[model samples]
Target chain A: MSMYVDMILGGVFHAAVVFLVAAGLQLVFGVQKIVNLACGSFYALGAYFGITAVAGAAAMGLPSVVVLPVLLAAGLAIGLIGLPVERLLRTVYRRDESHQLLLTFGLLLVFQDVMRFLWGPTPLTLDNAYLAYGTAEFAGVRVPTYNLLVIAASIAIAAGLGLFLQRTRTGRIIRATAENREMSEGLGVNSNRVFAAVFTVGCMLGTVGGALVVPASAASLEMSVELVVEAFAVVVIGGLGSMRGAMAGALIVGLIRAVAIMVLPEAEILSIYVVVIAVLILRPAGLFGKAMA
Target chain B: MNLNRRSVLRGIGAAGLSASMPGVFAPAIAQSKPVRIGILAPRSGAMGTVGECGIRAVQWAADRMNKDGGIAGRPVELVFEEETSPKDTIERFRRLVLQEKVDCVQGLISTGVSMGVAPVAEEEQALLIMWDGTTQDGVKEAMPDARYVFRSTDNECEAVMSSLLSVKYFGNKIKRVAGINPDYSYGRNNWEAFRQILTRAGVQYEVVAEQWPKVGTMDLTSHIAALKAAKPDFIFSSMLFADLPVFMKQGSAAGLFEGVNLALPAAGWQLNQLKKSFMPENIVFGHNTLYFALPDASPLQKAFVEDYMERYQQAPHWEADRAYFALAAYKAGTEAAAKATGRWPKLDEIIDAIPRQEVQSLGGPGRFRADKIAEQVFYQGLSTNDNAYDFPTLRTVNAYTADQLQKPPGMDFWEWLKTAKLPV
Candidate 1:
């Protein structure tokens, strides 16, 4: 019974983090029509920056309870890095998909070295902030209260994003641009600004995910590349350019992983890919993805 | 000769070749030539910091040797290359030996890498001193008759030692055992060796849960939850990288550490990164062959700690200590060979002299056995916050002698462990 509770909580917590990064991937691809392979770099940057931010916050005598908000702010601030990255990516906007991939892959490599230079080679962790929120009990099983908060936070963000996209004036304009860039431009919408905004928001989602997860995990040079693997898995399983797909994909992947670890430990990673293959075979467009015209 | 275009080009080519490939041209040049050592260490990934520490120690070794009139009276020159994957490393090894013409090659931390490069060393006839290749069972099985390759002490020593120390500290209370090790050869070997020793020592315990996360797994919440659910009295883990710190964080947050006795044999490598708040009281940590405090009054250790702290602003760990051993062995063996032959010795001569020679190290006296493995005393101890240092220090230090833990030469590790007796 406790094991079942653990599986559910662990899976949900993991899904929350994965969903943020995947949502970012979906948004960028939806609007820009470019696969930002450097999405993982943004996540890594946020994680490292989150550590620094928490340290700074602690030195300022901020209470431990506020660590979550501080991390979110740090993630959002660091997300501005996407502005410059998006600008640089503009040169390859009209180029081939291969060129975009190669360019982003190059950025990923460069970001790794740049991070090493700034943070050193050792993995950085946020120690005090992790247990700050404390743990909660559920039917004899103990879970971190922070995990629950992050789950709630993720749901709130998902709803907020969904509402904004479906309701707001700017959101509609952004959606319109994503739907048809040339048509939106003819209607006097600034597609360049829209792309920049969408890319930055997408980057923020990744950074925030990284920031939130850092307290529980670590910020290592390898995290960027490692996260890319999972994020891609989420994107493919959910649908390439669909936000709803991102959420569904993350949950499925996360729950499957939790279940796999419990049953067959060796197939933890293999199980995710197996489902990916199945999803690709069964629903080539992904669970929530729209079928192509 | 006529100054034709072809002749001019030929002359330029010859001059360039002579200048760039001096080792190829000047094979007969005696004395005053530098003794170049090729070093391979991971410089840009998870192992980078540990590798950087090894590089610092080797550089210090070279500096000290030069200050004392160099290795065999030749100034030491180090040629460094990043040790990436096995395939890339093999190519780098060839470049270091064939292109740069280094006298000796050293420094491989990964067991997989050591297994890959050991045979290559034999093929190239290069003197290879491995700073770390902890897999005792696999490396021995792959190259039992290796002449060119010399490795540090078998990693089994530390595992066995960790088991002994854990039993000594928590033996009476431990009824259930669990493991959360990296899913790799190194982690598997550590857990296997530890389990063997514990089971063989007649410490009856039930196996509850075993979690083998991939090598770079950052999140271990599920593993922690699994362990907590199993309610293991003692947990053994060999996650020595970023994963260790993450596990500690997540595990502590989940309150998993409170009731569980943890034995982490490689946690000393991440001693600095570990937090006092997250650390459990009843845990035993292994340092492979290093204790930052050194404990006893050894002038060599005192000097090394002081010098390393002043230079790098950090305490040296097992990687640094291993690097020192590698260099000290090379210098001792090379000098011995030279003294015996009355000239700069060959690779075979160095190999012959190494086992016969004893070298002093930070960990104390060290010497290779006839099987070409260094005999090192492994350290495992309880963590204490009573120390003045910012990070937690080891208390109740226990040393496990290599002879008691290591398998006898020409014997398989698992086969020997069945009949092996450790002092309870």
Candidate 2:
């Protein structure tokens, strides 16, 4: 029972990292209709920024309490880097889908190389400040309190996004533009502005995901490819335009991989593809995605 | 890219003439030609740390050789290449051998990249010296066909056997063992070899748990939890590069190594890369390698580390030592072969000469087999932070011979393990 509980907790925490990345991919696809292959770069940049910020704070002799906010600041700073990139992406929006992929894939490679030049190839580890508090016992098993913080943050982000989209005026405008860009433009909505906003938010959330994860896991150059590949799977399985779909897909992938790690190591990655193929053959929309009319 | 009959013959003519040149390249040496050696290591991935160190070491050795009047009195020219990924390894390797026409190539870090290029080297009849990749069993299998390949680093079996033997025979209450390794052929191979040795030795022991995380996995929560649950006395790891730096922090935070004995085959000095604020405790590394904090086995070893520290302004990785040693070994072999055959001998002669002569390293005096595998004394020790540097490093250790840990002479590794006595 305890083993199962621990596995479940592990799966949930793992899912949080995947969800943070995939949700941004989902958001960009929903509004801009562009699958940012470079979404993983944002995640990686966020992680590297977090490393810098945490290191800077330590150098200044700040208390460990300063690390969390510094990590958040790092995420926001990485979000700034996405602005010019989003403008570059805007130029290719009218091109073919292949062009978008080629451009973004090129960015991915550039980002990886740039990271290597700056940080070298070794992974840099930056500890979470909350780790000082030690493990919190739950279900008769000791768990890192940082894990709980990450899980709660993921949930909070999900709920907060839902409310923002449904309640706020700006969020509704973004959603309206996503539904039908030309129609929304005819209704006096500026699609370009909408895309800029959506793209920035997308990059921001993706990087924040990276920032949150640095505590639990360190960041490295190879991380972008691994995270991007996995996030792509989540986006594909959940349907490209659905945020909730990404969360659902992440849980399924995460829990299944977690269980597989315990029971059958071979099935950890294979089983995710099995479900993907099943979804393609059966629903074709996703576990929570809406069917196209 | 098109191969024409004339072009093929022209290329072949150049190659054959280079090979059959009279007076062992001395004429070229006198006429301003240099002995070219190619080196390949990762410069843009997580493994880049070692690659950067390797480049410096190779240059350091090559520069020193040239200053001392070069190889065979011809200045040694070193060409460095990136082993970017295993996907492009063959193309890069061929470029080094055929296009640039380097006389030799060394510094293969990834086991996959090295294994991928071994057959190509053999086919080209090039002198391919493997400096630091440790997939011994697979490399050993390649030896019968891989005529030109020789490794300076100890293989998986030889590297880990000493410490495993010590813990099993000499320790107290170490009956349960668990392992956390990167999910790859290298890690799986090490685990399989280690478990086989433990089981065959017939100790009162059980492997309580095992975790094979994907190679670049940063999240080790589930794996650590599983290992902690198993409650083993020792946790062995084949984790490398980024994984080790992360493990030191997270594992220490989770109290993963509070009482349990932590063990690693290599990359143990990865702990030294961490800050003093976040370091793991009481790790028993399998080898007294990881150059930054090694036992001074010889005067050469002492001078190398001191010189390396002065030159680089930081502690050199064991890879730096290995790279230096590989070039030194090549130089030694070339000299020996030249003395015997009265010319710069063929690739076969150089390959044969390398194993016949002993190579000095930070670990101690070592030699190679005809099959190109290593036979040397290894030191395995528990690690402690001396606080001499910002991070912790290894201190005390127990020494064991390659003959004791490695497979018996002229017999297969598994076959020998089946009958070998428990080293009491």
Candidate 3:
């Protein structure tokens, strides 16, 4: 029973990182009508910024009370850089998506090389926060406290985003803009502002996801490239532009991977790809996604 | 001073030109052509971090040897190529040897690349020294016919045999064993050899869990929990490179490695760089093909480590030692062959230089056998960060020697394992 609990917890922890990154990509596609290929760079940036910020905060002899808030502040500041990135992206909004994709793909390479130039190829370690709380026992099985926080934080973000979309005026306006941009503008919703605001929030969520995972897993050059592929898979399997799809798809992939590690071990990665292919064949609209018609 | 690729070529070109021009440059013409060595290493990819170390070792050995009067007064010239995969290796190797006309070639730490490059070098008749190819298939099955290919690192068989120290130390505790390795040829080979060793040791060992995650796998959460549930007394791991820290961090957090004896055959030497405060104790840092330190280790090993520190301001990675060992074998073989032939040794002569001969190495004295792979002995050590150095260092955890860890003569490795009594 404890082993099962541990496996489920492991699945949740694994899913948390993927869902958070994919949800933003889904949300941005809803408002902007464009898939940002460079979203992976934002995720990598978050990890790099997170470790640097966390270390800087600790080095300043700041109280531990400021740690969580400081990490949040660093994450929010990173989203602001997306404004200029979006402005560069604005040029391709009216143009073909291939242009936006090519431009963003170029940005991804540039960001990767720039980070490599600064940090070199060595992996960065800032596992201090991850080690701070130590392990918590649940029914005789040891659970990493950092993993629990990641699980809870992902749930909180998902629930909060769902509520914001359903209950808040700004979110409703954004949703209306997503459905019909010109009609929302005709209804005086200010469509451009919605696009900018949606893209920013999505970027923040993606960045936070990366920031949270870096404390446990060391920040690596390969992390962004791998996450980008998984994020696309999760979003594609869930439903493009659907937050619920992102959540559902992440859990399914995560659980399958977790189970595979226990049962076959060799099929851990292969299992995830198999489900995505099966889902695409059966339901192209994804689990929570609505059909185009 | 360091010589880049262009300058070394320019010097060679000048020497070649001077040889033709008679009177003015006749003294330079009398000097034999530089014995050029081509180095194929990854400088831009994922393995570049360690690959560059091999390149640096080549240059360091070249400079030091050249200053000390190079082999038979023929100045050694080293050329470096950034190579990644087997295809990349073949392409860069062609350019290095066919176009540049290098006398010899040294390659990356990957076994796959070495397997591909072996036949190419043999067909071209260029001596190929692999700095770090630890895969058993390279010598045993992959390129057995290729006489020119050589390596100094311990292959999969010797690596597993070295873990016998851990078994003897733990005694009855090793009744149940688990293996956590990457689901690839390298890791599979490690497990097969380890399992065979345990079976032959006459131990009633039952494999509790066998976890083989795909290459570049990041998460090992459920894998850890499952292993912890198995409650195995020992876990043999072949996980390495960037995947290590993630395993160490998450595996340690789940208390997977706590109180249980662990063996990281591939990347155990890297444990010294990790912090002692967070690291798992009792990790059997099994002697890799060439670890820097050994109990009653060779004097040449001490000189090599000190030389690396003096030059690079840090302790050398084990890959650097392998690179240095390749150079040492080349130096010994080339000098011996040159003395016998009374000129620069030919490609075939270099291949036949030190067969069945032993020479000094980074870890100790290693033998260049008939198969062309330099067979070195193994010794076990413990993982610790707070030892004698700033980074993680071993404290000579065990008292076992090469004879105890190695497969003795007059029998096959498996045959000897089945019959021979292990020395404790």
Deviation in angstroms for A188 in model 1? Answer: 1.3
In model 3, which regions exceed 4 Å deviation?
A61-72, A98-100, A127-129, A187-193, B1-34, B44-46, B134-140, B152-154, B293-300, B307-314, B354-357, B384-392, B397-424
Worst ten in a row by lDDT for model 3 chain B? B1-10
For candidate 2, chain B by itself scores a TM value of: 0.84
Clashing pairs in 3: B272-B392
Measured over all alpha carbons after superposition, the RMSD of each candidate to the real structure, in angstroms, is 6.4, 5.5, 4.7
| Number of backbone-clashing residue pairs for each candidate, in the order shown | 0, 1, 1
lDDT of 3 by residue, A1-293 (tens): 88788788788788998898898889998789789777887787788788789888898998654655666677777867677777788888999888888998888877777666766655676655666667898777789887887788889989999999999999899889999999999999877788888888888887888777777776666777888888888987999989999999899888888888877887887888998898889998899888887
Query: Which CAPRI tier for candidate 3?
Result: acceptable
Listing candidates in order, what is each one's chain A TM-score?
0.98, 0.96, 0.95
What's the residue-level lDDT of B137 in candidate 1? 49
Q: Which whole-number lDDT from 0 to 100 does residue A133 have in model 3?
A: 65
Q: Which is the winner by TM-score between candidate 2 and candidate 3?
A: 2
lDDT of 2 by residue, B310-350 (tens): 87666776667667767878877887787787666677778
Error of 2 at A151 (Å): 2.2
**Which digits, one per residue and each the tens of the lDDT, describe model 3 over residues B1-424?**
1121122322222233332333222233225567677877765444655676666666666666665555556666777776667886788888888888887787667877777777787788777888776325622455545577785444564455445755665656788898888777778767877787776666778999999876556677878877877888898887776566677778878887777887776564343335554566656665454566555656766766678777766566656666766877787787777767766667677778866457666666666667675566555566666566544456555543344554443335556555656664
Residue B87, model 2, lDDT:
60
